[model samples]
Target: MTHEEKKKEESHGRPEIPAWMRAVAEVISAPGYERWARQVAATGGCSAPVRLVGESQVIDAGTGEVLHIYRTADEPTGHLLVACGNRRGAVCPACSHIYQRDVFHLIRSGLSGGKGVPEAVREHPRVFATLTAPSFGAVHTQRERNGKTLVCRPRRGGGVCGHGVPERCGARHDGADIRVGQPICPDCYDYAGAVLWQAHAGRLWHRFTLELRRQLARRAGMSRRRFDALVRVSFAKVAEYQRRGLVHFHAVIRLDGPGGHDDPPPGWATAQLLADAVPEAAGLVQVLSPDPGNGQRVLAWGDQIDVRAIVVRGDGGGLSDEAVAGYIAKYASKGAESSGTIDRRLSCGRCKGVGTVTMARGPAVCKRCGGVGTAGGLDLDRLPVTEHARRMIRTCWDLGGRPELEELRLRPWAHMLGFRGHFATKSRRYSVTLSTLRQDRAEHKTAESRQRNGLPGPESTEVLAHWRFAGQGYTEAQEILAGHISQRAITARRIEEQRREGA
Candidate 1:
């Protein structure tokens, strides 16, 4: 067509069918789906919903044989409706808002004793602690307190690294500084060591916990194996990425009796005792491996260990059980990609240059400006170095594989490099479990649905459903609608929370 005609056609384009059309089609094709479709259509618009097509056998109560066959226009079509559980704020806000609310409830339950947890747990010796990775090199940092800016890292000048760069930062940086993650001198940073350390951080934490238990047992004047019979330790932890792209950890540790929820701890169990044990355990713990290239690599916790006794007032005091639990739940849904790493494997052999990193075959190189010898490069023979810089190097091989160090592998989390532990894990005695919390929420949702639908009873005489994974994303129209829904949900929740607090 001519350019003028094409312009007109583009300007007056036909309205595209809503993506929820599939769901509508499924509903129309399923047995008794016509009624449900009419109900759904009356609600105006739902960007996307599950579409199922199937047959149902309706049998008489007194007879074993089927009394009737109910089918939609398509004999085999059956459809079921299920909520899409998307939690990203940028994507489906409706699902994300629901997810966030569930998380809040889950966390609050763990803190204040609901969802099967004993209320007495509020008195348990619990502390919210943060463990950070050691600095690979100095970089830009944001500093602010009481509305005033401060020097990012104000160390004494004149100190120099092995590479002769100044070891201190003097610049006053704002919160929006883009150079925060960049090393002051890339060569001076122990990139290999940092990545390798990250890869084995989960293992290190495991060892720390085990050692902490041992130390606690010794302190209590009991044998290591027999400690569980007297007292049990429970903890929930989440990993956070620092400005330098290294993973650190935030955790809430609690002490309880041997029988978990059924019993209280002995009088000897106190927050002070747990606090003391943390640093000692951290210091004594070590992960050893015989290196083929080097003689051996002895990995130990960094010197910057912090152990605090969390209280109910002050800076550390304000760290309530609810707040700690909420913080952990928020981080659980995140992945490494949230911190700016590529979620998929970098492509081989495609190098552009300097500013742009491209994933392609050959060696991983910057797509914008080709730069090699970094974590994104194709030097597989060297090591998988990038964000964790130190740990992914060849020198750290067998770091988490020693026979004496089986507890550190975190084998369940192999996908997250060697940091194979749950984003949040709790010992049985802590308070409540994630499973119980989820079930409680589910039951609440079911009851709410029943109430809204004005069901005759809790039980349903006939329930039919079918569902499939259409895809896990939203179209432009759905995206807009989801945003509005999410905003409303958030506002409503905030108001509710405020009302509850006021009451």
Candidate 2:
């Protein structure tokens, strides 16, 4: 059998106890198994947990008397496990689900106004806008109308391109078709332009926001300075990867008074005005690509810009506030990995770049792949990605080596197809920050723990903590146990949500 086939068979082929199964049995019967299981359960079964060795002390601030003490050495295991807060679902589903829920609350608060924001902000002018990348080449796209799929890129003559590739395709591609995002003519595709556009997408978005303010000012027949002083622009946006391996921004743009959400915007600042300014600003904004070999190229937003008015209720035929918030939150946990890219970075195959590999018996220094991450590494040529994404990755690698394009750092972000921007971002005045949300949750948990333990409040005590990173992730045996816990947690959460909705 081939290597892939053998690996697949080993996972599900027979009922015999394999080496991994034997390891699982040993782990389950180990002395510290109960403690390990409790730690894993507390982390919500994080796929990749961060391991830490630490000691903490809580002392009375006024008297300097020791109040409480904790150490990893006291636990059954030598380390403490913390969830790796990765937002990408492909990397860690449990953590991603938490991140998604947090994002939803963040966005919803900015709309309906909660979590330290004023309720009056919900009455302010706001819009849901989609800014798309300019097309570099004709790609296979799925289109539907009136409950029926339409032929993709149909043409009367069905002519051929300069590369002797067909210019038109009549097939009706379904959403799951492999050719849904591939180029009709690979040779004729503008790979360089596409990569450059992707690299500069963040800058393009920044420029568009600036131009939007300018457009709003001009529409109001006021100077830019006066407009800035009178009104503030707040937004929360998430980047979603299109099927063609490019990112498009979906944003909730709002107008507020100069003092922020607490103050009312000018009377003229209506949702209709914001909607009118969006398309004009997107059409006007442009960014210049790095002049690497090819002369400077101008990149701008695509023609298919969508701007919709956000309303309090969807019953009146406008996009609802909750709908817009939920839509942006849903895409927050996604990345280029959704487009068939690997979730983790390529590294040493044997040791996985940690300089050591866990053996059947115990951990051992890897001699086969050495300590360097590149030894026995993945072959980029054999990556199981789409042809379009492969070309984009190759282009990023090639351009990354040039001295002129060094600032883009394309090599490290090849998995993202040259897109190096954050998946979710927001203006300072938009709402509560992700860090703030996380901090609040942490404080709440700490308070609950202190109450349960009959410990003093943080205001009357001082805490000192010392921690060192140990390692991350789980062994084969722990992974199986954690996976079951994670599924159970998800099912429980779903049931709770259904119950709440029904009530």
Top candidate on TM-score is 2
TM-score result, candidate 2 = 0.90
Task: List, residue by residue over 1-503, the lDDT tens digit for candidate 1.
Answer: 99999987897867766767665454446576445534333222233444434555534344344544444434232333344554443334445555555656555554567767767666767666677676656666777889988876677655877888777787887656655666777777764455456667777898888999999998988998888788888776767656566677777777778876556778898888888888888888776654434565666666776665555444554476656666666765565544434333332223211223435654453543245422355443443334333223232223433444344441222223334444555555555565675677677775775576554333433434333444433445434544455455456666877899799
Off by over 4 Å in 2: 1-16, 346-377, 494-503
Looking at candidate 2, what is the lDDT of residue 127? Answer: 93
Model 2 lDDT tens row, 1-503: 89999888778856767888898888889898888887887786589899999999989999999888889998877999999999988889889988998898889889999899988889999999999988888999999999999999999987999999989999999998989878999898888888888899999999998999999999999999999999999999999999888999999999999988788899999999999999999999988877677678888889999999899888976889889988999999998977766565554556544456888999887886565433465566678898888888778777876778878877667778889898899999999888989999899989997898789899999999999999999888888887887678667776886798599
TM-score of each: 0.68, 0.90
Per-residue lDDT value at 457 in model 1: 32
Scored by lDDT, the top model is 2
Cα RMSD (Å) per model?
8.9, 7.7
Which residue window of length 10 is worst by lDDT in model 2?
Answer: 371-380
Score each candidate by Cα lDDT.
Answer: 0.57, 0.86
Clashes of 1: 40
